[model samples]
Target chain A: MNRFASAITAFALAILAMGAAPVAAQQATPAVTLEGLVKLEKTIEENGKQKVVLEEPKVVVPGDKLLFTTRYRNAGTQPVDNFVVTNPVPDAVRVADESALREQVSVDGGKSWGRLADLTVKGEDGNPRPATATDITHIRWTVPVIAPGASGMVEYHAIVR
Target chain B: MKNARTPLVLGALAATAIGSTQASAAGVTAGTLIQNTASASYGSGSATTTVSSNTVTIRVDELLDVAVSALDAGSVTLADTAVLSYRVTNSGNGNEAFAINVSPTVSGNGFDAAVQTIAIDTNDNGIYEPGIDTVITNGGSTAELAPDAAARIFVIVALPGGTADASASQVRVTAQALTGSGTPGTSFAGQGQGGGDAVVGATTANANALGALLASSASVTLTKSFAILDPFGGAKPVPGATVTFTIQAAASGSGTVSDLRVTDVIPAGTTYVANSLTLEGAALSDAADSDAGTASASGIDVAIGALPGGNSRTVTFKTTIN
Candidate 1:
């Protein structure tokens, strides 16, 4: 009878101890946690002249090429995806060149757009020729994604007629 | 055992509470955040936005004022006794309130003030004396005026009723604002005055002095005439031809001729040879010629350079037509 009682007490004590041990252990060791962060930074630089070139500055009247370059920096801590930037050409100027990233051509003063390949022009033979991407005067870059702290540059050329 | 469990539970709760607070302060949660999100451990921050603009410019316009008039003298025989009538008006912007007065200063042998009665004839009698006045019946007087205002006044004089006419006379008209102010406003007073005069004509001496001053028959014939003679004559050459025209302009009348100019019409079927003309031997290239091709040649300007009582000159021109 004595042995039975002792055995039963021991079993009960072991169960309690097991429960208590788990709780104590949990308190002793710190909980594991995850922290995530997302940050964005931007830098923009204008490339036009400080003072407007009045009368076109008499630059070699026959032909003139003006290059305007704009730089956009993704100075943030996270990646930027599908970034879109737009620039308006002044009334006195016409765009002559576009970046390789151009995807569409806007005919109605850039209010709407169409694919370069889909655009057509009557050839000397009166047949349509597929407009090359180079024929596009405006550009839209779908970076797909820009890694954090990355930068990009877009440049276009203007010819004074 | 119970005490130990209590402490462990409290510690876990405390850590969870602290973490939750930090997350709340960072304004983020496990759920979706409609705007931007940041981690609590990374701390808090802010962002700024900026914009740009352009410059512009502007412009404005201006105003002006001017006028002219005419006067005439009737049958006053004495050189100093000739009076005339004039109507003046303000043909400009704003009001014009002022007084105007006139006087005469004569030199040479033709001045005779005593025989001249410069009176404001208020009555209409064809004569300047008390009973023969005309201006009085015309309702004209000397008074102040506002913009576009008008006034008329008369001058009277005494003369040898017969043919002893007065030669020339110098007349001046001085005007002043009744309110003692100048043009444009009531701040300053307008200085000086403006007016004109006429050259003297040859006078017939008094019957008593005629015999002594006359060597010839004393028969003086005065005539005033103007002509456009072609110095290089021959069929009134083409309108713009470089032709010289002699002006036999003379004031043979008893009085002198002042402010004289001879204007000629290029005739029908003719066009102004632009900028190819001269007057009084001087090239008149700067004169405006707006009537070049018009049927009416209104821009024929020939300044006679002051034709004395008896003087004239020849001018030439050359031009091309459209």
Candidate 2:
């Protein structure tokens, strides 16, 4: 190919990498994706220190807390800055305050977020029990930047109602 | 003209290079996707990536809570059938079957009746309709009760015809949560309805840990005595003597006797005083409605209210010797 044509082609490819085909940018140049999983929490004493870890849950019952993880990966060819990821807590479950990742909870669907301790839920008597796992509707994590081929995960524990 | 032409030409011919300064643009963008997705913008437009994750949905575990309630208490005659009914409730999160056991033997708790038979109210109507109800045998079972539901059970205890007066009996009924089997405090996985999940509740048949009470018939006895007042002043027994007849009735044993009537005939030598009836040191009219007694021509008839075991009543009247 001629040098001038090669330069024009490189320019066009750069513009394409910018995700400029109207609505085609979202599907361009590899994509950052997310995966979720649910696991059970187990604690063991290691060297006189309690080490908490998540294990696969075979079956869970009432009073048992479960951990949910959402892993995000930047598989795109180009570096992407400022990414937002959200995960919803299913109905009939409450948040378990022990979380591996810093997160915010949304009691009103996914519209807003706050600390779990500050949130409140109406109890059987109509009074408020400080919102725990049971009051969380959604969980969120903010990633300042997700470089190409980078991956990260967020996790929080919850108990079934 | 030459100078004016030269200045116009210089102004028209001037070719000076110009420099320009730039700044930045202001705006924001948003995006979302099904299941899970990520959106990032590096200096410009960004694409969102989405991936689906299977939802690990499992039904909530069922909690098994059992409770028992006894029927109201009433009087029971010897050799009679006293229906001791108990309602077992499932105050849990899931449906559960219960086992009912009634023990005639009374040990630590309290007195008890001889349990002849234990029966389950199949229809849950609480009445002991023979055919409708089935006897709960050695290993009897009750139908499943949903959360907050109950089953009524009846125990028929034949009062020993020899059951002595004042002696009491107790009938205790116990119900256990039969759904998930294990010692209390032990939990199992997927050992519940629909094979979902469960936690064993009360294992003892007596979930309520209470006993119903039944007491035998009470015995009451009557005693009569007399004290005399002198015709003028002091205590004396002679012609024209004013005699006060005291009748005492008391129940000796543990139960209660209803509709107690005490009748005394006027002594042959004494003329009955009109309106001279007093019960327990209180003035009583000569009528049935007054003070549970009455005084008529034949004699004094006193109708005491129910005489409970270990209780007594005193009736007094004055008669003058003619």
Clash number by candidate, in order? 20, 12
Q: Once model 1 is optimally superposed onto the true structure by TM-score, how far is the C-alpha of residue A84 displaced, in angstroms?
A: 31
Candidate 2 lDDT over B1-322, as tens digits, reads 0111112112211110011000001000000001222222232244344333333444444556677877655534433456777788776556678887777776642345667777778777768887778876845878877666678888777655435664555556777777555564455566655455566544332375444454566777789899988877877778888999999999876666777888899988788888898878887788767366688766998778788778999999999877
Model 1, range B1-322, lDDT digits (tens) per residue?
0111112122222211111111111111111111111101111122111111111100000001213232453323333234554445533222333344444433432432322332343443434455444333222223434334544444443322222333434343333433332333122212211111111111110000010010000112223232333435533444433333333455443433444555565534445556545554555654445321121244455554334333455544443321
Model 2: lDDT equals 0.60
Query: DockQ winner among the candidates?
Result: 2
Return the lDDT, model 2, position B195.
58
TM-score of chain B of each: 0.27, 0.49
> Which window of ten consecutive residues has the lowest lDDT sum in model 2 chain B?
B23-32
C-alpha lDDT (0 to 100) for residue B148 of candidate 2: 61
Q: Per-residue lDDT for B21 in model 2?
A: 7
